[model samples]
Target: MLEKIFKLSENKTDVKTEVLAGITTFMTMAYILAVNPSILSAAGMDSGAVFTATALAAFVGTLLMAVLANYPFALAPGMGLNAYFAYTVVIGMGYSWEYALTAVFAEGIIFILLSVTNVREAIFNAIPKNLKSAVSVGIGLFIAFVGLQNAHIVMGGATLVELFSVDGYNKLNGVNATMNDVGITVLLAIIGILITGWLVVKNVKGNILWGILITWAIGIVCQFVGIYVPNAEVGCFSLLPDFSHGLSIPSIAPIFCKLQFKGIFTLDFVVILCAFLFVDLFDTIGTLVGVSSKAGMLDKEGKLPKIKGALLADALATTAGAVLGTSTTTTFVESASGVSEGGRTGLTAVTTAILFGLALFLSPIFLAIPSFATAPALIIVGLYMMTNITNIDFDDLSEAIPCYVCIIAMPFFYSISEGISMGIITYVVLNLLTGKAKEKKLSLLMYILAILFVLKYAFL
Candidate 1:
């Protein structure tokens, strides 16, 4: 049945491998189950309801990816988009959460139209092959930086960022943290990274999945022995899952289907909708390009087969997520963890979707998996994705310089879309000025994109 459904033999993968890949993907990205609710609640939404909405949105979106695209990708409320929804739109702009959601819903509708019209696929095909490779490498660095920050192995410092130090964290955050609360967990994360690296070197099956569970187990042991202490005020919590409240799903009635289109005709609403559309479009394209490239799923033309299905799935997921009462749902880059684990079919996405569905009822257990445990998986996956750098045409400065700019901008600017925007602009400008535009045969869509990005920076 699995073979018939996912063409497992054709993809050179089996059920065991795909399932493991799916679990690895879920473990790495499960942080969203906890994070989305926290961020959305800041926008005056109910946290419990948001948790339910997030889990349902992920389940619905990931399941759609499997059924529609048959690809090993997962979807959820995106990180940066959520922050903008909460902080910028709702709080900073003083708009109601309902109003913000209406913009996201409208953005999703536009994306669906774009996908149906093949505009998104055209943009994907229009990017230069070297820049596509650069996007993969850039995401590697971006996610690695994210892993470091998540584990508190990297923290804000006098010089902007620095290595983990107990005193430094204390001073920067104005909190009284100790080795038991902050220091030991960071040490464990470092150890987990080295251990996971060793497993990768030894060619262990399901190394990434095992790495997360092993890290969590070690934290549990540390907490048992008093080496690690749970400090609620400092964001540290018990490693053990708290099941005292029992297994029950939260109701989504509070925020579900609460869209407000009253003030959406204004300029401010258009800006918000455009922001969501721009970020979600590029981020999804960037992930599909990066992860698919690493998984060897792209054709010789540097394009993924059945890409319209993938884009349509993402488009539908974003629209569905808005209706479910969350921020923009998009393809998660952490799906690279699954691809690195040898996932090549929809079975992997189905497995991830099942986990998300289970999370609705088992929230405490899934949310108990801390960032420190998953951090190693992301760092290791980053290492895997970074190997794509060899595919770039370094001999050609016209290609190399923009690729370099794209690669550096992602982690430095802390945005995948920003990296792509800078890369496209630099790629078009450099090639045009150097008399290589005609030689490269850059498409008209590429020029339009560069101009659009330029206008985005100029005004928005």
Candidate 2:
């Protein structure tokens, strides 16, 4: 039955290998189970509910990838997109969480339309390759900065950002922080980064997942030894999961289908939707192409067979994830781990989906994971994304300048959309002025985006 469905022999694979590959993929990306709730809850969503939503979204999205695309890829609420949703849209822009969710829902619908009509490929090709890589690099810096802040390893200061110091943090926030409270967590976060980094360096299969769990365990040990104290006022609590309820799923009622369309037609909302669409489109395409290339799944022309199905699955997953009360769910780059393990058929994805479904019952362990522990995963993932910087052609002045602008603006301006907007505008204007516009053959879509972004800054 499995062979008939997934063509295991046709792909020169067996059930055992595929299942093991799926497990490998799941372990590589399971940090989302802990990190997504930590992020979305910052946007005022219920953390427990977000945990359930995140797992369910991963399950549905990965299953869709299996059935619709028949590929080994797995899906989850994307890392950078969730940060943009929580910190940038909800917190930075003063928009309500419902408003941000509405934008995500609208973006998903647009993605679905674009995917089915084949416009998504055109859009994907329209952007300059260097700029796309720059976007990824910029988001890397942005999210890493967020991780540092989350762990209180970085704080606001006279210089705008400063290293963590117990006295300084207490003075700045008017709170009493000792070595046992925020100080210890910050120290743990630092140690966690080293541990996670070492794991990555050693080629550990589930480095990030193990990093989070080990860090949390260390914190629990610290609490036991009285080196780390639970101070609720300082946002430090016991690092223990409550298994008193005997392991049950949390209710998703807090965030399920809670989309708001009251201000969907506004300009800001349109900007938000475009940002979501832009990121998801390129991220999915890049992951598909890169991973498929690694797996030797691409055809002679460097195109993956059944790419349309893969894209449609991603589109459907994003839409479904919004309805499930999470951020845009897209193909995870960690799927590369599975591919490297010989995951070639949908069987691998099916196995991965089943694991995500099973994860729903392990909410207690996931929910108990503290920000300090998960912060290391974010930082390490940021390091992974930042590695794309090697792909940018720095020798070309026109391309390099815009790419550099895009990369720095993200962390500096503290907004991904701002970085993208500035990058497009800079690219178009610089090329036109330097007489390189016609030479580079900038796409009409690029010009249109540049004009729109300029108007955005000039007016709003």
Candidate 3:
């Protein structure tokens, strides 16, 4: 039955291999369960509720990916997108979390429409390959930056952001600054990075998960030794969580279907929706390109065979996540770990989905894992994604300029959509100036998007 459904033998795999591969994929990305709540809570959502939503969203999304796309990709509330939801939209743009969620829901609907009509593929094919690679690398840097901030390894400043030295001293001012009190936390983060890096270097199968767990245990020990204190700047790694209840469910009703659309119909909100739409669109494409290439899911023309199904699944997941009270849920690049583990079919995705469903019941234990511990996993994954930079062609100045703009703008501007906008606009402008605009011919849709991106930045 399993063979008939997933065609495991044709993909050169058995049930055991697929199961293990699914476990490996789930283990690699499970940090999302911890990390998502930590991020979304800042948007004034209940941490516990967000945890449930995150898990449930992952379960549903991964299941859809398995059955619909028949691919091993997993979906979760994306790391950078969550930050955008919490920091930029809710805080920076002064929109309520509810309205922000409305924007996400809108974007998901747009994604579905585009995917169904096959317009999404046209838009994707319209993007210059160089810019696509750049978007991937840019997102990698952005995620790593977010992880470092979460772990207190990096601190924001009035003039600019500053990196904290391990000694807890500021080199520029020769002063013991903010990190002075949290020196131990900084040290733990460094130790976590080292452990994760070593494990990765050693080719450990579940190195990321192992790194997070080991670092978390060390933090518990630090708390026991009194080196860390709860809710203190220096003791972030040591804060103790309540575990009185062995098993409990956090109510998602607080945020479920709570989207407020009254103020979200404005032009600025439309631009915001477009931002979410483009980020999810390109990110999914880039992830699909990477994971599919590894799984041999791409065809002669470099197209995914079941791309419509895969994209529709992602679209639905984003919609479901918004309704359930979380950020954009999309395909995770970490699924590559499962592919490396010999996952070649939907069975692996199904296995991951089942684990995510189980995670719903274990929210208490999972929530106990602190932001600092999960921070390492994000940082490690960021480093892994950075490898995409090697594929960009630097020799072509026209391509490199936009790619470089994209790579730098994401972390600097703190927005993936902004980075993409800058990259696309630059790509269009540079190509026209270089006299390749007519020769190569930018797609009509790409031109319209480029214009919209300019207006979005200029007016809004």
Candidate 4:
């Protein structure tokens, strides 16, 4: 049955394997719906709507990808872009939630154009394979870095040189405070990490089960000790949105009455928009290429299978997310894990999508799952993503420099787009300086992205 459904490179597997694989992929990718919205909600504009829209649209859009694109790759609102959507638009620039939505829509349009034209893939051809691999490894390092920071295992201290503070007394201006909240946080984080690692290393099919079990155990213990992590938003139950009050741009006008065109022409906006565009383009391109390579989805030409059509799926996913209220579209790195389960066909995606749809009905159960608990899973998955970095040819300047740039810059800048933007700029200029530019196939899109990066760095 697995062979009938899945055309895997490896030999056939049982239905049980496919089911388990699908479930694992779903679990890993499910966080995007919850997390992307959570972070974007911080912007305090259209958050409720954005959250709802992102969830609903991502559900529908991802299903489309799963069924139509027929790959293990999962699509949803991405990492770096959501932060920008929240920070740059609604917070820093003080744009209305509507305009931010418009900006996203604009980018979505660009993405659709690029995909339909097959121009996006052409541009990505210039990226060295090693750099592509480096992106994966760099993402892994990123995840580990995030995990350490979140676990408070890595912290800053008061030495002239900062240090990771562990179990140190709370020194308050020459005074010792009796309370020690940091220690407790550290302990909880460790407990979560240890339990998660144990399950993963043990090859437990459902590692998240361990998270729930440990979380409950910790909760019970803390309750006995008169300590608790409250579910303030919902008392262990998720709330459904009153659709009458819910915002929907695709359905409603959304008060997009007048264009706030004043700041639109400014260099700041131009740089930011272009910066965002390039970041969106490359990150999505890189992820698709990486997952395609790992999933054995590469075509005879060494290009992603049905490259243009796949981009369309991604584009529609992004647009759907925007109307539903999220950031840009992106491919999930966790999709690679699904391949391990023999999930070679679109059925894997269908399984995942059905689960996501079911989740909407069981939102209450999901809401009960806390963010800190999920962080451990993300931290681990991030570790897995780092594996791609090792493929970079460290000896080649063209590949090595760009690879390193992307690896370090992403975590340092705390944004994937920023890292990608830095990388493309490096690739273009380095190739040009060495007179090796003529040797590589540089698309019009690449040139434009290269130029965008140059001016963005210069002004932004």
Q: What's the TM-score of every candidate structure?
A: 0.76, 0.99, 0.91, 0.74
Clashing residue pairs in candidate 4 are 53-324, 133-388, 134-389, 137-386, 137-388, 137-389, 140-386, 238-364
lDDT score, residue 87, model 3? 72
**Residue 50 displacement (Å), model 2:** 0.6
Question: Model-by-model lDDT, in order?
Answer: 0.84, 0.94, 0.83, 0.60
Q: Which sections of candidate 3 miss by over 4 Å?
A: 165-181, 231-241
Rank the models by lDDT, top first. Answer: 2, 1, 3, 4
Q: List the residue pairs that clash in candidate 2.
A: none
Residue-pair clashes per candidate: 0, 0, 0, 8
Compared with the true structure, what per-residue lDDT tens digits does model 1 show for residues 1-460? Answer: 8899999999999999999999989887776776677568769998778888898889989998998889999998986677668766786678999998889899889889989899876765677889877877886787778778879999999889999999999999899999999899999999899888987788665577677778889999999999999998888999998788888787889999999989887756765775577667757987888899999999999988887888888888888988999999999988988999999999999999999898898776655777788788768867866887998999999999999998998788766666777998999999999999999999997798788778878876
What lDDT score goes with residue 46 in model 2? 97
Comparing 2 with 4 on TM-score, the higher-scoring candidate is 2
Better of 1 and 2 by lDDT: 2
**Stretches of model 4 off by over 4 angstroms after superposition:** 1-21, 45-51, 70-73, 80-101, 130-182, 206-213, 227-299, 303-305, 337-339, 439-447
Between candidates 2 and 3, which one is better according to lDDT? 2
Give one digit per residue, the lDDT tens place, for model 2 in 288-358: 99999999999999999999899999999999999989999999999999999999999999999999999
